[model samples]
Target: MDSIDEVLGELPLPPYVTAEDVGFAVKALAVHAAEQWPDGPRCRNDRAPHPCRLHRWGQRVLDQRGLTDRQVQVLIAEQQAPQR
Candidate 1:
């Protein structure tokens, strides 16, 4: 079956990665986290295949920012932490 991206196309990335873009990216990854199904992994939020479009877009944004895996983890952790 054609993936959502194949039908609707990918969401556009910002021309320039900014702080706000990074924040949004972090949220996207957090919200679009994967879940296991009998067949395979899928997006927790949308039930689409794992690594859904928004998840990929967020990864690309982080890649464009040259963030290390550790940094990305920290960002995700911080994103999930309770706010004061």
Candidate 2:
């Protein structure tokens, strides 16, 4: 069985990385985070494989923006925090 990613292919990156794109990417990473399953890790949001299309796309966006792993983590943390 082909994975959803294989069927749909990768999501396209932005033509130019912008602050808004970075914010969307951060949200994607947070929402598409992995969860442990009896079979294996899978996407928490879609039940697809872990590192699903959106997750990979988010990583690519952040990479294009030259964000470090630490910086990405911080952004994700902020994204998950409660909004005032």
Candidate 3:
């Protein structure tokens, strides 16, 4: 699948992203992160070609939130880290 919502149709973005949206966006980033594949990389969660829809959505959200590359890396690492 390309995204969890694949064929479900796109949802509209909020006029402005709220804290709740950020939380969801972060989760999407974590869950939909890219993965390596024999046929080339794909989304770990969605199994779409790497950097799939949700991934792009997450990136766009992070960018809109003014996160830098380094900050984004930190965010991704934090998301991937095992919980205590």
Candidate 4:
């Protein structure tokens, strides 16, 4: 099976990264977050290996935004956290 990253590589980039692109990136991250598996926290969104396309895309966008790993983690946490 091809990894999501591989598929992502095949994807063509849009003319430019816009706000809509950011939204898609966020969705990708949330959808492709790791899941707790019997073996380990594998990618739940896609069965095609860990760090799926969406996940990678999200991380890339976050990176472009100048976020560190810790910062991305916090952002993701906030997204998943309960909205009060």
lDDT of 2 by residue, 1-84 (tens): 126567788899989999999999999999999999998888899888788888899999999999999999999998788999
TM-score of 4: 0.65
Model 3, 27-84: lDDT tens per residue?
Answer: 8878877788889888888688877777777778777877787887786688778999
Name the regions of candidate 2 deviating beyond 4 angstroms. none
Q: What's the C-alpha lDDT at position 14 in model 2?
A: 86
The residue pairs found clashing in candidate 1 are none
- CA-only RMSD, every prediction: 1.3, 1.5, 3.1, 3.2
- Model 4 lDDT vs. the true structure? 0.67
List ranges where model 1 is wrong by over 4 Å: none
Candidate 4 residue lDDT tens string, 23-62: 6767777878788777666677766455766677676776
* Alpha carbon deviation, residue 43, candidate 2 (Å): 0.5
Q: Distance (Å) between predicted and true CA of 16, model 4?
A: 6.2
lDDT for each residue of candidate 1 in 15-82, tens digit (9 for 90 to 100):
99999999999999999999999989989999888889999999999999999989999999998999
RMSD of candidate 2 to the true fold?
1.5
TM-score of candidate 2 on Cα atoms, chains taken together: 0.92
The Cα RMSD in angstroms, rounded to one decimal, for candidate 1 relative to the true structure is 1.3
Task: Give the CA lDDT, 0 to 100, for residue 60 in model 2.
Answer: 98
